[model samples]
Target: MRGQFPRVFVLPTKLSPVELDRIEGSVAELTWDAAEAQVFVGKISRRERALFELRRLKVLTTETSQPMRDHRSGIPLVKGAKTSTRRNGTDGPHQYQDTDSAGHDEFQPLRPGHIQVVRLQWLEDSLDAGAVLSTSNYLLYEGIKVENDPQPALAPTQVSQASTDDIAHETSNRPPESSQYSAPSQRLRQGSRERRTSSGGRSIAPQRPVLVHETTSEHDLPLPPIPAFLHTTYSCQRPTPVTTPNAGFVEELKKVRELRLLEGDSIGVRAYSTSIATLAAYPHVLQSSFEVSRLPGCGLKIAELYQHWREHGSLAEAVEGSKNERLAVLKLFYDIWGVGDTTAREFYNKGWRDLDDIVEFNWGHLSRVQQIGVKFYDDFKLKIPRSEVEEIGSVILGHAQAIDGGFQMVIVGGYRRGKAQSGDVDVVLSHPDETKTLRFVEKIVRALEKSEHITHTLTLSVRNSERGQTALPWKGEGRHGSGFDTLDKALVVWKDPEHAKSPHRRVDIIITPWKTAGCAVLGWSGGTTFQRDLRRYCKAEKGLKFDSSGIRSRSDGSWMDVETDPELGPAPDMVTAEKRVFQALDLPYRPPEERCTG
Candidate 1:
């Protein structure tokens, strides 16, 4: 049954996004293009409504006069006024011999290109029966494919600034004129009309910039081949450059993903993450919806979004979310240093619409860290310049070395990934001797605080040192709490005393044993998606558990010697050690710049 089902297309009309995704996933052979579907499944029941849906999809068809017959049984497969049932009350193979004036029994001879519009129940019943059920009881209309009438020429104002080749590529991949799909340009025209009528001739919001013209030819010059690493589902295996041709579109998607996060839609967040990772790795600028549909993790719905974005210069949902008051408030709380989605919703539920509200009404109820977050919310929101980030790292490293001259540090996080500025500073400090690192987090924070460089300690954890600084056993998920990893660390607020006007900044100083410095650096350097996939890749493929603390064999929970080679011995520097760790994991060494799987 895996691939036996007909090519099916589920209409989005009158269905929730969750419902649409569920039905799409249940289909064994779901086709993105309506023109390729042998069956159209939707909630619609009336003949006129079904025909309207077909017209919306640009499916031109001629209604058949005769009832459809099952080729295998040579029996009429049309439902009558009454359905036959077995003794057990299950659907029976009832055949219709006569029809009313409306031709309820009328259906086209189902063939390769002909289509049958059926109620959603057909899918439900087929799954319940564990077989493809006959459509007799569910059929609403049937039609033979027909050639599409000519579309009118585009008006002068309707032309886009896209390259000729891109337009040609879009045209070449378009479904047949009378097929079960409308051209993107045609859809945009219809969408414009709908918006104008619904909103009294004005757009709901200002649109984004038009898609810039692309010069690459889809035919004369081939699309850059997908990198071999991208073939795998793990994003850590792929190279996602910091700058991509699709960065603008990716940012648009990130906004929607962020909205989902604020709305507490975990599934939606994960779905968007996968799509964003895939698109981030794609080298070419998208030219058509078909291009989007073919990419890994991107499906028909995402492709439709790409089409809409290309035509409208913005996603409707993203624009609408930006203007949503609830979402806007949630985003405000979520942006605080120590607040998460759950806490953001909690704040909103308490009627704390802004930082002022929280400060005035719920100041005592907030955690110490969250209270600090609200107090310095404006300062924390300010982007830390690369120069400032480097200065901050230098100051922290200076303090660590003051305690012990052997201390060495590597600034990880976005700064190492080639960002012009970072939201915060993250530096991993280590020493050549194990004794120097044990319980080092407290010493470092105390030193910074004494020097007036540290304003507040958000949270300090010595879990790694308490657990003897070894990789904890892999007890699977839910075994770990908010910290997730057991690296000794300090989350602190820092401000330069040298410059009184400087903004307060968030800084994380992590202390790792010199042996696992590679793991610490690797884990913290990559983007969120890159780090997630790295762990997943390790667990699924290498039978190992990975965290910023260290990597351990899942089979026996023993630490793997990833930083040392039998010939070269231990790596001399943190960066070199990180390269060795990648090699030991059987992963290609991706530079920090190439690990931006956002």
Candidate 2:
């Protein structure tokens, strides 16, 4: 015989059709006598065996019933009996647990070797065999041996106990299912442990990590114990302390908490925290929490506020804690046109805390626009609802579409992003002919102003071409031109109605020609920082400049202007243009909604 005995491998489940064919091919290539052509099958788990039995009956009745004979008797098989003999040297029956609570008496053999082939195919179809073969968990065969004499099978009682023990062991040892199964956090912990072991016999001091805890009442709650792995001794220099304004800093924390609650889980909470951290003078303020929980930088006391917000809308004992006074001061300082946080802080330290104080003592520091900002501080703070934004967009769209037959206008911003409420409206206008957009902006602004809807106007100009260019000296020219060839002329309008006492509602309008529609749409439909990073990526890595106009190469030192003439060929529309840019740079064109980045 080419091989004296047949080797059987256990599988987790039944095989697919493709896998069954592969197993049959391998078996045909092997040379063995009819008596020696024995094949044994094993089940890896009880659940797998149950599933296999269910599929085997279906396959036997549908495909071939003749193959359902018992190997030893050559008769149709019955369950609960040892139908096939073991390899010559084997001493007992293959002891396997009953998969279901019911006995295996219902299970009928479909074929003598069919189950073996099915089991083998199941393993081949489901798993990457190469990956499994390389793993420590997989089984490998070195060789096989057989004896002429066979031994007696095991008793039924002995088989039952062995199967029960296997069940208990598997339940205890199997890993739990988790969201991060592909990129398990345990891998990081393993790496850190490995590093500590390699560093030799030096004792390291543990650093104090911040812990946050939620409060039951007004008083602070105790923090949870640090994880054991974090207690590892390692010496690293402490980071430099950050400076924070002593005046009304606590109140600002409360406002941040309020904003967090109002925004809820959907808004980018981490981004908001990072923005605050970067702006705050004291770095520890970033760590401060209103609740007692495991906030990254905050500890027990601050974690209380976070918990309060989660459970209730307002902080219990902290309602009157400098919040009103601080808001008044902030509102006053924010109105000064040129004055931001840095300038406002200086004024606050000088005892100028209110609008009257700022007007009297800090008039020289304030710009004309800041004076206007101070004048309408209360009105500006009110949020514009989605309904109002829609009304305003419709009004603008009506006027734009009336002027030109080819013009198309789309309302973007938070409304387009599917938010329930919006702060302001952003409308983008484009037309088929590039030349038609030249004087369209001015005409649209005049039309809206005449309707009595536009009460006031601010910052009306085409976005300058030189806005996002790198300042590099040219190799062989008088001067290197800007990266952006076209600029989007934007108009900011203020809508005032007789019903509302407020001065006007803010609306941002952008108009782009057909040639630059793709870049303009992407730039305008932004969460701000996302578009900035995209431009940065194109310039720094791709040696290409991208803006509201089009993409251009630094090497050519020339504009790769998109042909906008529809008569000539296909004009660069949003989808086609973006695809072209991405293809040229060898990067994927991401959808507008997924443009958010770090």
Candidate 3:
């Protein structure tokens, strides 16, 4: 049996040389035994004892090599017994007692020489190896082993004839007591009496005792189970709902399905139009919404819509409000050059709801460019296809190179990312020699304008005086007003006469000098809010000022000297320069496609 049981050896920590030597000696001296053995040096915490007991019990019961069974009946021992017993004077129950011996009376108390109970304890400061050996020996004697044990015996009284009524009455009528044996003893006594009366004096075999073993020290006895009613009294109660007075009308309507989609529903369209109106009328509201939950045009209904979009996967409504003919015509008119909501609304109020009305009215309000925009309104709204963008790029590049041998041009907006179509073409013009940047921009625009490609132009000159101040809107300032000096370049929007006005197509050309090329590229290649965020990060975190020209130091009022060399400069252009800036600030560079807040 010892040989059948596997050996288990454990070490709590790395063994020193001396400890290793001792282990070697112990192993060399261990002799082959039929039963299994394990050697461990670790301290076992109290929590591990129960698990160890279960493992040991399983091994002993199921893995023994010997086929030894009950000596009297030659049957295997029963497992998982609910009942077992030992006479008061009998040897304390052996760990692995057999169970098939009926009509046997071999069980007897510990005789003068048959049994021994030895107790020993180690001194508090003891370090003697001999004391450890003694403890091990005593443990070995008490340890359960199946090979050397005797069969288990039954009790002296059976309860087979006890009526169900009598058993129930006996259990219910019993009083709680501190005595260890009182309850079982009373039950057994009642059962015995009832059996005798029911059987009419015939002698019967005694029943098994319901044995229970508990290992607590005398200082720790088991407590009784608590009554069910006592537990219920201490449990937590459910919370009551509280009423709120300020909940909005839409919220108060339990069955309301407030629509909130970007492009489809009537309510969503109104909400979106309201948002756009709010942004145009009160741009400050955009910044305010980031901090507080309340703002003009941002009522509970809209807030609820934004919150729902952020949390749930779907919106309840879409943004194309009831399709009014006037609204559609106004939307179409707003797409033209030099026109805005105010002008569109003015036209609507005057009964000029369509393009034909504006043409027929023949007003002084329509400028030459606006007239062209109205003429080609449909085509201008359509995105410029990739092939057209390339063709336009070739035209601009050829014209630019022809003006100066040193000139270079790059397509820098969404088109640069290889998009299928573009809203407008953004070209970055530069030269290797920084001194010629001003001349380069002037000559390219001149050359393009001479080709009859220029239809309209808005030129802004950079205000060097306002370089140190921030551009954020201040109190009392109008929404569209940014009180900063303008740049010295022209923003030319033109119609391609070849791509005529039945669907009038237009191109926007932004020309900036080489000195502010990087900043200009970043500014124009915008999903507007993204560029704003990048600028904010530069100002707040890096203590650097960013604008169309370049990044500069805020503390000492010095410019960042970014050389124009292909390999050594901050970057070849603005896109790479922005990546470098973000990397320097330890932020991931967000790609253009993901820039849309929607």
- Model 2 per-residue lDDT at 85: 30
Q: Pick the candidate with the highest lDDT.
A: 1
Tell me the tens digit of each residue's lDDT in model 2 across 381-495.
5678878778888888888878877777767766654545666678778877766677577778888888877765665664432333222222322344454434545435475
Which residue pairs collide, candidate 1? none
Which tens-of-lDDT digit does each residue in 1-598 have in candidate 1?
Answer: 2114566667655555556555644553555456556888876554555665676666678787876554334456554534342222112222332221122222233586688887676677666555676666566678888775334433444344223443464467665532223343333212222122111222122232133333346335455665566556678888898888998889988987786577555545656777898899888888776677667666555676787788798888798877766667778999987899888877776666789898899888889998898889899999988999999998998888889999889999999999998999999999988888889899998889999999998889999899777656666545653226688999999988999998899999899988899999999999988897787778767888888877778787667778977998877889999998999899988999998888
User: How much does candidate 1 score in TM-score?
Assistant: 0.67
Q: What number of backbone clashes does candidate 3 have, counting pairs of residues 3 or more apart or in separate chains?
A: 26
TM-score of each: 0.67, 0.44, 0.42
Worst 10 residues of 1 by lDDT: 197-206
RMSD of 2: 24.2
* Clash totals for all candidate models: 0, 24, 26
Residue 529 error for model 1, in Å? 1.2
Worst 10 residues of 2 by lDDT: 232-241
